[model samples]
Target: MKRNIVILASAITALCSCNDGASDKAPVADSSEVKTAPENNKYTSQPLVTHIYTADPSAHVFNGRIYIYPSHDTATGTPENDNGDHFNMMDYHILSMDSVGGKITDHGVALNIKDIPWAGRQLWAPDAAFANDTYYLYFPVKDKKDVFHIGVATSKTPEGPFTAEKEPIKGSYSIDPCVFKDDNGSFYMYFGGIWGGQLQKWNNNKYDSAGKLHQPDELAVLPRVAKLSADMKSFAEPVKEIKILDSTGHLYKEKNNDQRFFEAAWMHKYNGKYYFSYSTGDTHNIVYAIGDSPYGPFTYKGLLLAPVEGWTNHHSIIEKDGKWYLFYHDVQLSGKTHLRNVKVAPLVYNADGSIQTVHSQK
Candidate 1:
């Protein structure tokens, strides 16, 4: 999927002020820091195995294996004009590793447009969740007109052919579809970005065409949430749109309108508090908020990290072996296009229940 690249400059300026109270401390290198290997041998290790081109990655530890679902973009820059005539084949791909510290292996495509009935071609950001012995994958796809819609698919294994339900979770021009299962055994899907639109619900527990549901006016904006049915195939309630960071927040000033502050929403509960992390000031920087519940009245926490070499940061938080880590994408050598390369970083929280900082991988 194409990101709004114009916001890169504004993101840099906004991120400069986000470090208000951050200490000047540097990241601590791992004691067993492995020496940098030759380019050909990079993929032979844990760190380099993750250095592949995978954007908007969602990770989970299933049966002692770490599975990563990401939007697959062509490594070859041969641009195929997708101007309504062709389908964007960039499907949701899966990569897995035997353990958290093991080398990741590419498992191939899990779901693609061809798998979905009447699904448009282009597939973008995807998020996955496990429920009732099944893996549910939520992702966005574009139709002939290039209009985006969110869809869901299921698979028995984390790395396998995911069966696309006949319908999408909700039909609308939406992207970054993320699924979050609550402690109460409830399911919720969150999505929305540049359009400044809100979230929607699948009240009927079924998928329909984009034109079937209400217009964008009926939906909520950034960081929206909706409750899903027990079966995880349909919605049990109206989509509840939540604005974790509103115009009143420090990052959303009128002056920063060019920045397009709200996008890339990812939520996870830890220590009895709900944390919502999102991209701000372009993909170059990230910010977060805290809420009491999934359908929350979230308050802005502040900027988590600034742009490093103009590389935008889109992140996901997962707890593995009792520790929390932030999985995000960054630019390799700089330049534009923001074709994400997966990276792992350690996330720290403050005593008062706020995010302290998200550091880069060592």
Candidate 2:
């Protein structure tokens, strides 16, 4: 059953600003549901589960076990369009596994759209984080006005019956909220998407439904990032636009949809460098960039994962027991673009630190 959350404006303000002095340690998974698998069988390219559709997997290692927070895809029969109307997801489910190629357990209904007081519909892709000894689930949904906003929920366990805050995070407009906890104990949220994600409409900091993407030569629409407050419930400061540049320090133009940011921002630290990877929506590629800081003026590296068997793809990268794995999704199961299933495979990195691209099995 879902837990009801009562949010008090005063309590939220205090929690968002207070210096709680809690350790920024990562969450330790309960051994009851997670076990260690043998090292011999590690890599896999199979769907995590097929009983139900899921997509945009955001994977993490909590206490050495893999936990996936994914968008629960529902077959609502809504017509597909450039605005993403066909993805009529209304809830989220949490998936877990002891290792790659091992059995996956679906912890059903971590959160539902009906539980969120301010949300109207469409519970799109979500990400999870652990801090202050609490598990946080960050998601994007449309509000009463039909504008997308990022909202947060909290729980004590990694697999959650999470209780959402009464309101959406202030100044958060767009989709795909990936919260990265830095080694320095700071948290950063990277988010935004074009088209149905509603990011292009807010280029001027105000919503204009007819607002279009930049010209072919102009600086393309960039993703947004902001540092989280101590409590991880709200932004500590104003949101800033991330600058993704090319090798020669040139901004990727709007016409370069194959290289420009469309949606799904994920950050993982590798060899002291920050890797920022995102999807090139229409072009059907998963590309990345590298930078010295989390908030990057990053230089484009290259494709991390090539085109998959669907119209959209989103993923997460995690290092477990010295091996890296890429968790992503495709429509292989249902053969419909809006219905996708999550899968995993080994992600290799060159000695030079560049990712060796993995092509999906169509």
Candidate closest to the true structure, highest TM-score: 2
The residue pairs that clash in candidate 1, if any, are 197-221, 198-220, 198-221, 199-220, 201-239, 205-234, 205-235, 283-312, 284-312
Off by over 4 Å in 1: 1-52, 75-89, 171-173, 195-221, 245-261, 281-283, 308-311, 333-338, 359-362
State which candidate has the highest lDDT. 2
TM-score for candidate 2, residues paired by index: 0.87
RMSD of each: 10.8, 12.7
TM agreement with the true structure for every prediction: 0.72, 0.87
Please give the range of 10 consecutive residues that has the lowest summed lDDT in model 1.
39-48
Candidate 2 lDDT, tens digit per residue, 282-348? Answer: 9989999999999998999999888888899899999988988788887755667887877776677
What is the C-alpha local distance difference test score of each model?
0.57, 0.82
lDDT (Cα, 0-100) at 349 in candidate 1? 66
Per-residue lDDT of candidate 1, residues 295-348 (tens digit) = 776777676755533334567887877766666665442222434455555455
